[model samples]
Target: MGETSKRKRKRNVSLTPEDITKVFEKSMERASADIAKLIEAITGGDAMTRLGVELEGMGLDRMQVIRVAKYFGNKPNQLHIHIWNGLNDSYKPDFVKAILEE
Candidate 1:
């Protein structure tokens, strides 16, 4: 019997921080200002599930899907990361800066 090896498939897609930010923003776009505020109101609830359900419904690409999954796994922490990409420049200083302070 001849030995044979199968090569593992690798994704050609390489997502830069910029690309991640773009995808996260795209996923966020599916959310409205009302929803964002609503998330704030329900802090201890299943915010990640809510966000993930919303992002999952948005039909994000594979990378974005994975990103959202990871973020959802750690809801409150990743909330900053998600909001950093999702929110406007004005709000970025708050959310993005929070991520750094941790």
Candidate 2:
């Protein structure tokens, strides 16, 4: 019979509380920067208003339109697709859908 060799498993390195906190903070900073870039790219001019109008036309209520506008204005950007993909399946807006289709 051939002898089977035992493989040693590597132990996972445990992170300290401070290390975890630092990691969390860095992650949050990166997320904030990403969101800031998206906002900067989408904001300015009457983009928000245009987004509101489009959303309203798509059957979203005024409040829903406002929330969507505040989150993602009409100024086209590379990140818009990411935002659209991140939306809840049931909440995808027609305006974004058209943009994505194009």
Among these predictions, the greatest TM-score belongs to 2
Screening candidate 2 with a backbone cut-off below 3 angstroms (N, C-alpha, C), the clashing residue pairs are none
Q: What is the C-alpha lDDT of each candidate?
A: 0.56, 0.61
Q: Write the per-residue lDDT of candidate 1 for residues 1-102, one digit (tens) a residue.
A: 333332223335677999999989887887776687776565534545555555555566666656645644566545444553466656634442344345
**Residue-wise C-alpha lDDT for candidate 2, range 9-62, written one tens digit per residue:** 334578999999999999999999998887756554344555456576778667
User: Ten consecutive residues with minimal summed lDDT in candidate 1?
Assistant: 1-10
Show model 2 residue runs off by greater than 4 Å.
1-8, 45-102
Query: Which residue window of length 10 is worst by lDDT in model 2?
Result: 1-10
Question: Measured by C-alpha RMSD in angstroms, how accurate is candidate 1?
Answer: 20.9
Q: Per-residue lDDT for 34 in model 1? A: 64
